[model samples]
Target: MKIFMKILGIAILIAIGVGFYFRLNDDVLTGDRIIGIAVLTSAFILMPVFLYVRWKGKRLKDYTLSEENLKKMRDKGID
Candidate 1:
């Protein structure tokens, strides 16, 4: 599942790059292209990466402040 997501994310990113290339090269800009880019970026790129990492047992709290983290920070003079 994780491998599949990684592949999907890469594919989406490539599609976005291609979309931008064509849109920028053209003389006329359309609302559809803008909307398509926005939706693809969020749904395909961001969502897949988020889900893949979460599925790997990573938690948001692990990176945020907690008693153990605070204590470590203080000891390291970073607090």
Candidate 2:
């Protein structure tokens, strides 16, 4: 399940990456109206991806920590 989620995330990331490529291809954004719309559409698909990857937890209590440091902090009553 985790791997599946990761793959889905990767797929979105790749789409965003491709969109970024088109978004930055400004020379292609010449006077042609059709080319401009297509490029903008590809780039706009990145908005959902940006939203997904950066979705934080609802509150501070749900944070995660690395195992080694979590243990050390646990021993020190910090976690």
Judged by lDDT against the true structure, how good is candidate 1?
0.71
Whole-model lDDT per candidate? 0.71, 0.56
lDDT score, candidate 2: 0.56
**RMSD (CA, angstroms), candidate 1:** 4.3
Q: After superposition on all CA atoms, what RMSD does each candidate show versus the true structure? A: 4.3, 8.5
Residue-level lDDT of model 1, residues 1-79, one tens digit each, is 6786677667666766666776677722653475487567778677967766776877777799999999999999995
Model 1, position 76: C-alpha lDDT score: 96
Model 2 CA lDDT for position 57: 42
| Pairs that collide, model 2 | none
